[model samples]
Target: MPLALNTLKRPGPLSKGGMRITALGGLGEVGRNMTVFEHAGKLMIVDCGVLFPEEHQPGIDVILPDFTSIRDRLDDIECIVLTHGHEDHIGGVPYLLKERADIPVIGSELTLAFITAKLKEHRITPTTIQVEAGDRRSVGPFDLEFVAVNHSIPDGLAVAIRTKAGTVLHTGDFKMDQFPLDDRITDLRAFARLGEEGVDLFMTDSTNAEVPGFTISERDLTPAIDKVFTTSPRRIIVSSFASHVHRIQQVLDAAHANGRKVAFVGRSMVRNMGIARDLGYLNIPKGLVVDFRKIQSMPEHKITLVCTGSQGEPMAALARMANGDHQIRVGEGDTVLLASSLIPGNETAIYGIINKLTDLGANIVHKGNAKVHVSGHASAGELVYCYNIVRPKNVMPVHGESKHLHANAELARRTGVPEDRIMVVADGVTVDLVKGRAKVSGKVEAGLVYVDGQTIGAATEDTLAERRLLSGGGVVTVVALLDPKTNQPVEPLEFLTKGFVHDDRTFAGAEAQVNKALKRAKDDKIDDIGALEEIIVDAVSSTLRRTYRREPVVMAVVVDA
Candidate 1:
């Protein structure tokens, strides 16, 4: 069972020879994955990433893990260990680097390449140490070992942190795909060796804990993709994550077999693929890939466009095509393949895009209708296998929501790991491992830091609430010019509204009510413009609520004449 939130207290100082673990993000949520490990007065971070904004978080570009707990200890960080190159696993590195740019970053070649390219876009050159699976390094007081893991993207890894206190094996998003396209499998031999070495705390990915059986291999998607290519008569447009190298490779193979030239549409898709190709992770046939501009001249049947926006992001190329706002427009007889899973909270947007594309006379193919995508995380059966193999003293599930965490914890329990040995907790919850025993210690500051445009950490919950009010209830502004001496209106009160009501005349009675309230305030000797403005706001709000049963954003501006 997870630790109770009410019982959580501020973490006390670390005891001698004890190690502290705190997650800044990626608990009870799916993104912004970060965790801080502290031992011997030093810290080592694992996976600093970003969470894409949901519909409720309007105008937000991305949500980052709050760095309040570590902002003061930036110099104490030895390095950041990245597991993969997915946005949810590496997107926030640039923001974190802006605080202190010299921190060393460690990852596989492709992972380093992705972050390096991303950091270059931010105009910050990062100090990176490239290491592959089986490489071990000792930084500060932490002994780190990287193990190969099979995920949606190539060059993924799972890291083992060995220290004087204990050993923690963090399985960054992974699955047991026996027949991966690249012929690389999850290294269970290394995991068994780590288990023999006695892993004290196992932090495993819990994203697919509720799912049953093993995840299907990437090679299994070949037939479905081939079918899509064979049946589609006109232009075929495939959408997927920019970081999914295996998926893109499969699409390339399918397009090649069907004798169609492929063009990558979105800037991110083009850039990331170029990086993957340069790193030898993506194998492209010569003359099979064409420029997007050149595809316009090719026959629709011979052209295949692979782009981003499988999640229905409005600004992505696929969504723009659905909205008829992109140069590569979808029309009759076109086949649109959404080759990605629907991320939670993105169902509405995805369905809306599907509807729009269907209305445009395009045949839609998705996971529901075809086997075009598979998860990158281990399922329940695989988790059980991992637990029985590793046989750790304690377990802490990461990279999932509350139910997923609980489900993963349950799997551990059934695998003979004592129920009390499982620590299921949310973000910021601290755990301490000492003498081979791990338990919840306390909590820290792990709030969502939002990014809006070029500003970071400026968009707060109150700002989102105000935006929701404006978007849902509209806004009503009451401008009152009051006498400087008596706080009486020097001129008739003016009401300006946007998205509040269709007709300004609808507020005629509201004007009378505000005037009466102002007169009463004046008769009561209320000379302060601020006080009078409150009176006007209360009167207007009451009138609107009583008449229309609606509560809009009522603003009163008081001016001294």
Candidate 2:
């Protein structure tokens, strides 16, 4: 169970020969996955990633893991071990590299290629070390071994870190799909071998812990996808994550079988697919894939478009098309396949896109109505199997929300792990392992760092609150030209309102209240512009609350005339 938040305190210095583990993100939530491990005064990080902003976080491009706790210790970091190439698993690497550019980044070949491509966009040339499944390397005091894991994306890995303190096997977002499109399966044999060597703490993905039974194989979707291609009367548009090479491969095959040329839309979809194809992860038949621009000229039944925005990102191709803002128009008889699951917190946006596309006469097919997507994380049955196979002394669930973590902890409990031995922690909660026992140590500063356009960490909670207030209640600006001697209004108070109301006359009561407050200030011989501005703000705020029953952002500007 998770420790009570009120009881958590700052952890003291690490004991000699003990390992400290702290999650900067990816606990109590789904994305921004990062964990810091300390042994022998050296730190090793795994999976620095980003969280997509929710609807409430206006103007935020992405949310990064707070690096404040380790900002001063960047030089002590040995390397960042990445498990996969998904955006949520590797998106924040470039931002972290900006702090220390020379930190060695270790991952599989495809993982390294994806990060390299992403870092190149940020103009930071990273120092990367490529390693694959079954590869072992010693960095600082940590002995790391990578194990192959099947996920939605190709080349996913699970890393086992061994040190004098203990061994921690972290399953980085995996599922036991016996038959994957790439023919790669999770290596349970390696897991059994590691179990024989004694795993002190097993940190596993908790994404699908709430889900019962094993996840269906990716191959099961092939029949459904082929059916979509065969039955669709017009152009077929399939939307999924850019890094989902397996899903894209299936789409390409389906399109080719149906005599339709595929075209990739969106910049990320084009770029990542090109990299995957070049690296032999994605197979494209000759003359099967065509350019998006060229696909426009093809007959509707002979063309297929694959794009991003399965989660309904406003800027992605699918969302733009749904809004009728893109070059590709969604008309009657067009089939739109959202070949991805609805990520939590994105339901409203996705449904909004679906509504828009439906209004445009497009036929929508999603996981809710069809078998177009399957999760990449292991479910309850798989988790139970892994727990029994590894037989770790302790278990800590990672990469999920609060319920998922607890559900995963229960799975461990059912597999004979003591309830007290399971650690369900949140971001910033510290855990220490010594002599093969893991316990919650303390807490640190783990908060959200938002990226807004060119600015990073500049957008704070208060800023988002103000944005929400403005977006919901609107803004009212009151400019008062006051007399220099008496602090009385030299001209009638000018009021400007936005998002609050359509007419300026709605602020007539607020103007009157401001004038009355200014008169009282003048009677008190208050001449300071700052003091008068405060009085004006207070009066307008109170009046708006009384009259309009709304509290908009009230901006008071006082100038001496």
Candidate 3:
């Protein structure tokens, strides 16, 4: 067993001490999820996920959890456990492995295969331990067991972690599906068994807790897709999360039954399909799958293209097709069915694509008034069922926004859990369980980290705010050359503004304000350059706010040459 986590090795003794739980992300909001469980100085992290960018955030695809708190103590990390293969839950694995590639990753066979494919995409593969439902394994001082749970995707699981303090059940993203397509359902009996063993804490998924009823099973999506395939006369296009291999299989079956050949596009869809087929998780008919390069030659009525970009991701195949940037453009007579609902905060981008596709003369189908997309999270009844099965001493809700957390808390209380036993934690807050009671002990430096192109570091809320400001307000720079000989201004101050305004627009008023500030400062003989810089920045900022009601970042350059 590993003694201490490498990510926590150098940090000073924690204030709470003993076994503590820190939610890196997914506490206050949905996505970019990570949770740290530290006991006896041994740390094990679960589900390092990434969040989808909001509408205001242009060009950014994902937001990952900051790992700085755990970076230095990776040596003591026993293992990295995964809940499923969804982007929000598993997207950060590559980034985490890039930092420390030696850490062992444990998950279901399908989950491990998916992670491996993702790692290979980044060219950084790590050691994987595949643990199925009912399998028990020990990592460091923690005893881990995988309990099967049904969700939109196959192989979704809730992890049962037994530590020295007590047994904690980390319910990964899950829904209680009675009529799931797969044979493996959430083993309520097993969860009840754990309850009998006396679980100290239960961390559950709150993504769909606020919804009134139980979520529709993944099988419910088939009839919707089947009707579209059976009725559409032209080529059909279906887009969804690539990790939903079962959904893809259902689409394939529907298309084949309707006498249409299916082609998988987008790099992610192709890669994941390959892995699913290889692992015997997905079975694709020999002639059903074809290269998109040969798509033009096939009859439009006989073709069904299943691609990515259901979230309106910029580089995804569907986005490229909608934007007319793809090699095979979306043309007339194509029936594009948006089988996925737009995630909250991505409505503008998704609608933009919808408009583009419609403008190109393709008929569009959506969930605007019909059941096209189904959530993979449990509702109140399902949550109650899981609670009744687990019956932990304490309840903690993870993997959702504040509203979901509040709902989950209420559900736990209504289900007979004590009011004092339920704890609501925000991101970065650590909860300590001492003698079977849980309370917030302290806070950790946890936030969002943007993994853009090649850079990986902390990109907190402030940074994202700055990005939004820069995009909207633009930037301004003022350069003044102060003559050291006479300590006076040599010439008219050079002012430059890019992205602040249009080419023809005149900022003469703003420029005059800066000049006036510089002249006033020079007359006073203000030798402190830093103070002068601040004054000029304030002047420009205040001017912009008055004129445009906007605040753009101002950089005042004082060069004494």
Candidate 4:
């Protein structure tokens, strides 16, 4: 008898150019994660994310991928499928929808709910389609299957994308846990069945590639949290990701174990808890959890607050608490636990909150000092285990930095997968899958889009140069009142300096020098007005640079008649 064909079906048009995949983001580093798959003339985006701006970025909010390459070809975008509801995976939707709003969005019910909330926040009503585990949907020419996978959050899934080329399984961030709080584990049976049927290309998570062993179960954190609630002498306040349902459950369990009522803070956190409870995904013991507003009415010893703003994003509930602007303040004898790992590029912001909390006489507990946080990523050994499970012809690491991807590739090599078979990809680099083998065909136009003030624009080398200048030097503005009749000065020439001075003191001698330089330029009075303006501005800039040893962007404003 012939063996059963237990593989995901490959619906075709994939061979039109074969199967090609590209990283829109989540390649060189984590955050701002987007991946594009091109099969049979159609493009499918896996996730869209936003990268947090660095410290040097004065007023920038988030960075997203420049979709100029595919924006024109958006008609080919069959559907956008989400793996989970993490910000790095879902945050870019508002930006993406702002540009292209008609595309269909497919994800689990919970994932769709989160996306719905995001759209409502942006006042956009997008067309969203909800799917479930083991369900198959057709987006353009591709047949996609959603396989349940466990992660820090519930409803995480691995997508089995089947095209004319072959079966490509993209595992969004996942780990194997037999005892998940939700009792849902990675569909190993499905994966093994796919392995038996043959997996064409495997794009897997590499965030925890360097660490060995499987990730600890979410249930395991309960005991440690139990210790905190039962042992601590002060009022307990826990801050974690709003979407971490398991952690929320653990916090509630620990609170109940310690005989305390729980109050959830942060609007997003509160809404998510209510949704999870309503959806039956999370159940906090009845009569044990109360609204935050009611917490103030209860005794501090009987209350525990689960909150948001773990990353210290401005205006989050925790930041408000740190500033004492929230309804509940963390005064003396309070203990705050940062129960989530710090996402990268947010250390300064997180530490700022930590400092404020500490200054308010609140005991701050972090990763090591307190048993608060554990990573959601699969470490090195776990990577190896997954590789061993779904032995594939080609391996591509996604969702981590270059260092992490390279490390995972090395682990793959140790597991006897040829180093040549491992491909480390960056944004816009395309890998063509031909006959179940993979190789980089060429590059696509991909770049970062920066959000400055209320305007959105691309982050080019010139923009980066300007950012560097702003960081290293200061800015100066030169304003002059000119006669309407002659396009000549009617008032004294003056320069204003900012971001390069003491708050209370200005260099009197420097101001005099600037005045003298402007007067010299005016005396020269070149016949050409444009030439004269350039000369005067140059003089002021040059004098300030020599005097203050700093270069300020000189803005020349001439009052002309």
Q: What TM-score does prediction 2 earn?
A: 0.98
Worst 10 residues of 2 by lDDT: 499-508
TM-score on alpha carbons, each prediction: 0.98, 0.98, 0.90, 0.88
Model 3 Cα lDDT, one tens digit per residue, 343-407:
66678889999999999988888888557677888898899988887788999989888888989
What TM-score does prediction 3 earn? 0.90
> Which stretches in model 2 have alpha-carbon errors above 4 Å?
502-505, 522-525
Clashing pairs in 4: 211-380, 484-561
Error of model 2, residue 528, in angstroms: 2.3
lDDT of 1 by residue, 1-561 (tens): 645876789999998999999999999899999999999999999999999888899999889999999999999999999999999999999999999999999999999999999999999999999998999999999999999999999999999999999999999999999999999999999999999989999999999999999999988999999999999999999999999999999999999999999999888899999999988999999999999999989998999999999988878898899888898889999999988898877889899999999999999999999999999899999999999899999999999898999999999999999988899999999999988888898988899999999999998999999899899889999998877666667888888888886476668788889878877877888877788878988999899889888788899999888
Candidate 3 has its poorest 10 consecutive residues by lDDT at 1-10
Off by over 4 Å in 4: 1-15, 452-454, 458-475, 481-492, 502-537
Give the winner by TM-score: 2 or 4: 2
Per-residue accuracy of model 2 over 203-253 as CA lDDT, tens digit each: 999999999999999999999999999999999989999999999999999
Over 4 Å off, model 3: 1-18, 458-463, 475-497, 500-505, 527-537, 548-561
lDDT of 4 by residue, 1-561 (tens): 111223313222334558888888998778888888887777899988788776766567788876876888888888889999988899888888887888889898888888888789889898998988899988888999989998989999999988878888899988887788888988988887777777778888988887777777777777677888887776898899888888888888788888898888877887777888888888878899876678778877887888888888777888999998987788888889888987767899999999999999998888858666667787777778777878877888898887788888888778777766778867777778988778776666667788876778745557666667666766666676755444456665666766655342334455455456545655766335566566556766676678667676666766564
* Candidate 2 vs candidate 3, lDDT winner: 2
Error of 4 at 3 (Å): 41
- What are the per-model numbers of colliding residue pairs? 0, 0, 15, 2
Candidate numbers sorted by TM-score from highest down: 2, 1, 3, 4
List the global CA lDDT of all models: 0.93, 0.93, 0.81, 0.79
- For model 3 the local lDDT of residue 136 reads 92
